[model samples]
Target: MNTTPFRAGHVAVIGRPNVGKSTLTNALVGAHVAIVSPRPQTTRHRLIGIASYSEGQIVMVDTPGLHRDFGSANATAMHKWMNKAARGALDGVDAALLVVRAGQWEEADEYAYQALQRESLPVMLVINQVDRIVDKDQLLPYVAEVTKDREFAAVALISALKRKGLKELTRDILKLLPEQEAIYPEDEITDKSQRFLAAEMVREQVMRQLGEELPYATTVEIESFEVDGTMLRIGAVIWVERNGQKAIVIGKGGERLRDIGTQARLQMERLFGTKVFLQTWVRVREGWSGDERALRAFGYHD
Candidate 1:
């Protein structure tokens, strides 16, 4: 019999935006808990996803990608909050996963690298998106170059999209976890609530449909969520910063809005495993992103 003591630890996933942090978190936990988009700054919050194992559980935190600058005056607030949120999650975590795209590290990645260096904790250098590397020979030099600068307790070369080499990474993470009882239930995949996930699903569809400045300007708030035995009644407001953005979200004759709702509703059904009646509206919340008070009210940050 394996007599090893139970282990549990929190691991923060940090990197540049779109480095597959959310995708990797989903693969590690075996569920979709964080939102993923091709757009930079897509992740606006720090989400915790729990991965259960026979010997222990790894509590993984998916954080916003660190960026050098928030943005121009218009976008500064959102990305500023994102940087704070990502930094906040690093505190008190047992270990860290410093994710990087397969063969290159850009300027935005420098922000993440700096943040990780500040933390006196064990970190694993996770080279994600390895599947994109058609030439395997080139990967070795890049990995070797990165490892020389910092001390990473472990190294995981895995394709988070293809789910390759994930088992080996999980094994290393398990070994690093401190001996302690599990903090969450065995079957729980994430600490996020259904309402939050529902909101994210809606936001994701909006991002996909809008596909530009529209995605950054949009935020989904679940105004009401009522559940009965057979179905769910969900009401959400898609908040935008300007009147023009609102019209864009609403689309011609409300067709775009309708499309967003229909797609969100279908995804909700799959997530909740029940019939869903979802209502979405485009509301203009001017300067909400820049307004600290407004952001705090919307659960962004103080």
Candidate 2:
């Protein structure tokens, strides 16, 4: 057999909604491979997290959280459909990282716990948001409860916000990984393209600025992306459900659009390491969510 000191494999990070799973995946990958927000159901699909090391590489899959409803088309009618989509991300993972929030586990946690019970895969129970707990003693009990599950290879407490214990957690993940050839080239960090990433960064900025139902109802598509010398020219369409929403996004004299463009351009510049000129247009796409063709055209459903 061909021998290399370093090994690589996929580790799935699964948990309930809004449990800092995306943040932790970003921290572990050493870049913004996945988007993070305080909003639940922020992640819609399985995102890859790659960690490079001297001995091996760890590819972490940050999955959409297991929940009753994911605010998608199947949200109310067939929740099992959403659950199947969430669980599909866990298949064939070499290891699993279970992210649990500190303090009392909620009813949603049971869904996650039961899901884990069905898996024989090696798991690492991660206690996220440790900074929120004022007393260190209060943390131990929950950790104990998680360890009792017997599916866990180990239990860890960490604060994704404060970036505590992430190094050790990284080491633990590496240790649990099975010896396999690197699935991805060492230089490649993510599966998404530059244009897709730019669109996501803009969407994230819009979510932060607008908040509420706007974040849920809005979607961004990159109409065009081109680089000329040191400047990056980008065109994107922001789709909202109703005419009023479009008016709100555009604002008077296109003021809000300007705000969105400015924030997105700044972030994109930092990410691409070049100056960016971003142009955005707001369009009302009624029934876009239910229209499969519209979803495909916007690159939402693949």
Candidate 3:
């Protein structure tokens, strides 16, 4: 018979842009609840990923990257909203994991550390992308330098992409949580709806396929999501800021749009565990990312 109590609580995965916060969240939850791309600021909302174990469960709050440029003159309404979403995730979280690249710590990293310190919560320094480092011997000294002036409850060197050192990280995180029943059911993986996930699936492909050609002003809106038998029929509108951008997304003879839909549909099928019939269309919404009203219409509200 098992005598240990089950522990569960929310842990905020906080970090700068493109530091593998979403990757870590997905790895821990054992599902792709949060979308991922190589682009910075890929995550714009606060998502809850539930990771369940026999002894405990972790309700991970995957938030947008905490960036400093939101207050700048060039910052858009979406930028401010992203920063707001990131900061808001800290509320009511039992602990935080400050994720950063293995061999790099910059001013942005220090800013994130300061924000977490202000909350007075137990913070664990997660050095991600350690698999990219060629010199493993320098890891110890790098960790020491980062932790010299800052107070961290624990430090973990992990490769969220390769799924290395996550077991120990989970164990340390569970220690910070209170002893209680699971916050969510074991089978549940995320707190988002199928419709929302569907939109994100399309956006992920857009970000991945377009790369630098795609502007940050781009977004996706689910026009329709209906279930027919065991299959899901999803329609998404890819919104760009200009007609030229729309042309770029559609590509010559609409081949790019077709590829995007095909890839996104395959992802939906894998995640939803059913056949997905997806339709995608590119439309222009002039400067929607900078317009507050447009942002709200596209589901960017706080």
| Structural RMSD, model 1 | 1.8
Which one is best on TM-score? 3
Please give the lDDT score for candidate 3.
0.93
Which ranges of candidate 3 are over 4 A from the true structure? none
> Over the stretch 144-169, how does candidate 3's per-residue lDDT look in tens digits?
99999889999999999999999999
What is the C-alpha local distance difference test score of candidate 2? Answer: 0.78
Candidate 2: worst-modelled 10 consecutive residues by lDDT:
76-85
Can you tell me which runs of candidate 2 are displaced by over 4 Å? Answer: 1-5, 71-85
Give the per-residue lDDT digits (tens) of candidate 2, residues 60-102: 8887788855545556322333356568767888888888898
Instruction: Identify the superior model by lDDT, candidate 1 or candidate 2.
Output: 1
Alpha-carbon local distance difference test for all models: 0.87, 0.78, 0.93
Error of 3 at 223 (Å): 0.5
TM-score of each: 0.95, 0.90, 0.98
Estimate candidate 1's alpha-carbon lDDT, on a 0 to 1 scale.
Answer: 0.87
Clashes per prediction?
Answer: 0, 1, 0
| Superposed Cα deviation of residue 250, candidate 3 (Å) | 0.4
